[model samples]
Target chain A: MHRMMSDKRTIFLMMAPGFAVFFAIVFIPVFVSLFYSFTDWDGISAYRMVGLHNYRELLLHDPVFWKALRNAFLLGGAFLLIQHPLAVATAMILQYCGRAEKALRTILFIPSIISGFVTSKMWVQILSTQFGLLNRLLDAVGLSTWRQDWLGSSSWAIASIIFVAMWQGFGYAFLLYYTGVKGIPQDLHEAARLDGATAWQLNTRIVLPLLQPVIRTSIILAFIAAFKQMDTVYLMTQGGPDNSTQFLATYLYQKAFSINLYGYANAISVLFIIVCLLVTAALNRMGRQEVGEF
Target chain B: MARANPAMNRKSPLGWPFGIVMAAFAAIQLFPLLWLVDYSLLKSSQFFGASILIWPKPAQWANYRIAFTAGHIPRYLTNSLVVAAVTIFLTVLLSMMTAYVLTRMKWRLSSFFYTLLVVGLIIPLHATLLPNFFIFKQFHLLDSYGALILPYVAFGLPFCTLIFCGFLQTVPRALEEAAVLDGLSVPGILVRIMLPITRPAIATVSVFSFLSSWNEFIMALTYVRSELYKTLPFSLLQFTGQYSSNYAAQAAVMTVIAIPSVVVYLLFTDQITSSISHGSVKG
Candidate 1:
């Protein structure tokens, strides 16, 4: 018994630094953020407790916040409605593409392997107004009138950002679906074929149903990514052109660093945390219930 | 073994369309990178005068030299290396220890601690940004490597630990028991038994943690103030701002920033994919 107790103590000691650092860096600060949200403390100021004022303003009065939230939703919707289907189709195609599968898979995953900063910068260069390839291509095709300042124009900015994000993230979705498709037993497909199912029926009935869990995981991953998106958005536009391209993360950052509204930023972050937790819980719950049904 | 259908073994008649589509998407994926490299060799005059689609005629590789000197890429590169290396080492060590305890130790709160660590994965990184910045300021650690290293390790731990835990669970219990019976200490078993068995897991975690620390931007931007302390990504951003009109120099700087990551990814492509797939499949 004494030996067991000593071992337990050792285990605790072993875990101390990891947990300490985790708490100091992540846990304590998250709570501190929650506490700061209720006050009007700039980073330097001796602030008053402005009790829910920040949240009130953010939730009810802030149009930019609404815009950020809407853009996030739109980005998430695009991932689901656009990127997911395309990834699934590509995965299925690659599965049937015989010798080209390995080469094509690697090609598709190129964007994902590069850093977000590099990819974002590359897109920024591609979208540059004066000497960008995109505009040059448009001009070459005699569609120069169709070219607008992609990153600068308000109407085009959000869409441009979305396109860049989708491009970068497409590889991840493709790989996931590819792995899922590869995992489906060959016998199942063979059995379905012997039952005289067409290729379309084989996909719809056997393959896709098995791929639902992967689809779910990808959607959740993409949604969280959209919600927490800051790097590409910050690098590309910094929520610019009259805040038309604002996102939750970038807005919080601008509030804290650019505008020095630390308290308001903290409020936004707390709300951000709550939204993330709720989304995660809701999605996992849905997964659980679906598994139960299965 | 079940045989795949003979028809399935052959390329489809529609393979051309599929191949063409995939190739087009591949081109889109790779075009910007190609452009970045192509333009990096152009002189300033050529950059301004030439069509964006045109290749460099007289390749002025001196642009890279100017980028290195003017952008101070070597210093930023060193800083990034130090930060990434330290964070990878520390995160892997700590995560292994935590995973060891969670998996092998007979603690009552093992599951609780496991949940605590795993929950870290879902917490939005931005939520911790301001508070950590404030805390670093309080500690007077701002503008130093510690500021970035601390958060990098902290944020990295959850994912690394989870990966280690998943891998550790598959390790046979008998090996650990045998090591203990041989009068090996807990640390001894971790070093001698656990470490070797979990090498692939370590590699996966190391690659990911290294990549995250190396490629991370927002934290580096928030924490570092001095040019001396700035990482490669932050330096590149600054370089762009400073040389916005010098597209060739900017492209050269970007290429310098990009090459290391691209090289690492190419070298560890299989490991990276396996690790990602492993995480998703297990989840």
Candidate 2:
């Protein structure tokens, strides 16, 4: 009992630094932001408590918050539906095709591996209206009319941002899926084959069922990326074209720092946390349960 | 059994199809990177009109220099390097110590401590922006390296410690018990006995820490206000930092910023994917 008590003290001593910073820097600030949300203060000045006015303002009046949340939803849905499915398809191919597995994985992973800021800037140059290579290619293909000011036009700006984001981050999902695939025991497939199950049937019945945990994680990660996306949007659009491409994170940033609506920004953040948690929980329940080796 | 009769059997599920598909995929993947390299050589007119997919006419490698100087890449590169290096050092140090204690010392509060670290990951960093900006301003750390490094370490430690702890869980407790019996103190047991065993986890942690520090831009832009501390990626906004429309200079500066990360990624490519698995798959 004495030994155990002393060991517990040692453990407490060890965990002190991590939680000290975690609480002060992350947790305290987050909860304090909740408090700040009820008050009106520019971040620079000492704040005055306003008693739920910020929340009221955000809920009742702020169109930008809704737009940002709406854009986040679109991105989340698009990634889960379009990007994640494509990632699974690619990962499935790479996994099944043994010879090309390594090489294909590396190739498909290049975009994700590139620095986000660099990739965003690269695409911006690619899609530039004048002196842009994408437009030039369109002109060459005789589809000149297909081009628009991609980042500059409100109609297409959000989609353009989402597309670039998908391109840059698809590698994460791909890698996750690959790991999931490789983790499955070969005996399962061998037994299925011996049982006279055709390859397609084996894949559908076995492979898909096995990769559930990975798919769940991918959904959670992809959804988080879609919401917390800051670097790409900041570099590409700065939430421009009249704020068409703003995500919740960037929008929160614009509110707190750029616009100096500290109270309102904190309000947005309180709600943002709730939304992220709910979405992640939703994906967890929706995604396949991982198989345990035990 | 799996390898012995390959020639006689002549029918393994593995085949050349993977090779062909991977090669084609590799080409597509390398194309854009190659385009950037090629574009640096040509003048603006030739570059812009040419498909970003196609090779350059002359391949003027000197464009890298033109772009570098135009972008003021030296300052941004230096700032990013300093920030990345400092943060990496601090993150590894803090997480290593915390993880060592948590894993090595079996205590009742350890699980609670571990859960506390998750606050960094799940709290939505956006919420902290205002608070941090305010705090940094209060301390006069804004527009300085300290501003970025401190917060970075805070955010970085939880994930890294978690990774190290995950890897540590697999290690049997026998080694430390044996070390304790051999008259080593707790700290000595950790530094000499346990740490050496977790080199792979350390390698994994290093990859993420370094990359996260290198790729961070929003913080760099927000905290580091001076022209001197501009990060390579953020400075690319003005195409060499002067706000000109010079594509060549922008590309050149990008090469500068991209070089270190590319080298780091190439060197640790194995570690990145593996560590990511270590971080996410277990828990």
Candidate 3:
């Protein structure tokens, strides 16, 4: 058994195919992107090496890059501050609900499963000015003054995009927290109850502490997702209303495809990876102090 | 079962409020889908009506017909299925083999390869877009199904491998040892013994691969230029462009495109949800 398991030939055969594909498609392209970031290649003509010129411009000159970076951070902050707490609370509420838990859980996760294109288009229609459901509903409720062009006006565009993104993403967050909440041993709850702890105290003191790891994981995932936000922004707004909703990925895509600034886009891609890694590393370091060892 | 908490077993005083809150959230989550189906049946003129939801006195099923024929739904749907099916098969097979080698086999560089593959989980897809485009163009793979399938399979490998490694860790090694005692070779044991045991993981990997490749838009948009190989989601973009004023038909297109994902999710909700928590927590 040892001989067969350790056969170098067998290991080589098993590992080679996946490694080849990963290297060619994913791994090598990252380096190639890094290489192209230095050259002023426009996808067709010969180019000269710029040597950190694109990076300098991106950092010091590009207003859109700054705005995109800020927007990405804003989205990440919203996820951590707004979406997560609400998700945890909802997961706790569902924990005690006897029979309706599964149905509600299923319903909540429907949005996450559907395509982003569908959700973005649906939200666009709902947020439309003239025939939009939101405006009609607001008027029906006698709050006609409340309605605005949700995606048209620059003021509301980013907020609308955030709201749509939150709606689309809330289900997965809820599920993660739900899994964490369910993993808490019922005995812990029982013990807390016996100790004369109120329900609120049971949640705040016991459940929240135990959910630290899950909270950390969710936050990191949210940050990575925020940096990776492209499809919805592209489909919904296309960084419109004077680029109010430009995300890093969408901007890189526009620079590459639309403007044909392949070199600059590659630079953006490199920076994109750096931002994701930095944020992930920082969060992981912060979470290194172990909590909830039970 | 009897020892289950009394508060959980019966309706606590807070149950009503909690249920209402959960129900409202579910409604919020589900309303857009319902509104979508509602509007897909209405005429284009009725879209601008006063009511938010105007029940079609007579449903306009022609919207679906137009979308199916004019939007090239069948062709795009077939292309998407081909891409998704091939991607899922290759991703599952390759990742399973990689996971087996990483977990079961002894090697000098096992941990090295493990870290190398797992680091891919955090590499954003945007980093590879331009370089991959140039690579495919050089290889003459642009505008072909291979353009999409290769990348999808590559991206799917890291996550699927992580899930498989996690599952394979929990399986008792005695199964493999016993199989070895039966004169089975390593590949034989992996095929007959390990494959069947990893059915749950396979289900998880398949669902995830299907979701990503099926709804994939950006890569498909960039890689495949021809209409023959365009996927389902791309058809929505084209339909919206071609018939910009036809709101109902566009809604119909979206509804049709969303059906497969919805069905897959409903079918594998347990596997999908469990694998998400397992993969994220461990990874």
Q: What TM-score, over all chains together, does every model reach? A: 0.94, 0.91, 0.97
What level of docking quality does candidate 1 show?
A: medium
Q: Indicate which candidate wins on lDDT.
A: 3
Model 2 residue A192 lDDT? 81
Query: Candidate 3, residues A198-219: lDDT per residue as tens digits?
Result: 8899999999999988888888
Ranked by DockQ, top first: 3, 1, 2
Deviation in Å, model 1, residue A146 alpha carbon: 0.6
Tens-digit per-residue lDDT, B1-283, candidate 3: 1134455547477777788888988997799899899999999898888787788889999999988887889999999999999999999999999999999999999999998886788888877888899999999999999999999999989889989999999999998899999999988988899889999999999999999998888899889999989999876776555687899999999999898999999999988897779755864
Determine which window of 10 residues in candidate 3 chain A has minimal summed lDDT.
A285-294
Off by over 4 Å in 3: B1-7, B240-242
Q: Tell me the tens digit of each residue's lDDT in model 2 across A98-180.
A: 54555577667777766887778888887788867678778889998998888889978888888888777777777887777
- Candidate 2 Cα misplacement greater than 4 A, ranges: A1-5, A43-47, A96-99, A285-294, B1-26, B50-54, B238-243
- Per candidate, native contacts kept equal 0.56, 0.47, 0.70
Report the C-alpha lDDT of model 2 over B1-283, residue by residue, as the tens digit: 1122222124436445645665676576566666666666677657655454545556666677766666666777788889888888877777987987776665666677776676456667766877777677777888888877877888888888888878888898777777767877666766897679888888888778888888877777777778867777766765533436567656766666666777777778778888666544643
The CAPRI classification for model 3 reads as medium
Error at B74, model 1, angstroms: 0.7
- Interface RMSDs of all predictions? 3.0, 3.9, 1.8
Model 1 chain A worst lDDT window (10 residues): A285-294
- Candidate 1 residue-wise lDDT, A23-108, digit = tens: 99889998999999999998786999999999999999999999998999899999999999999998887756666767788878
Instruction: Give the CA lDDT, 0 to 100, for residue B179 in model 1.
Output: 74
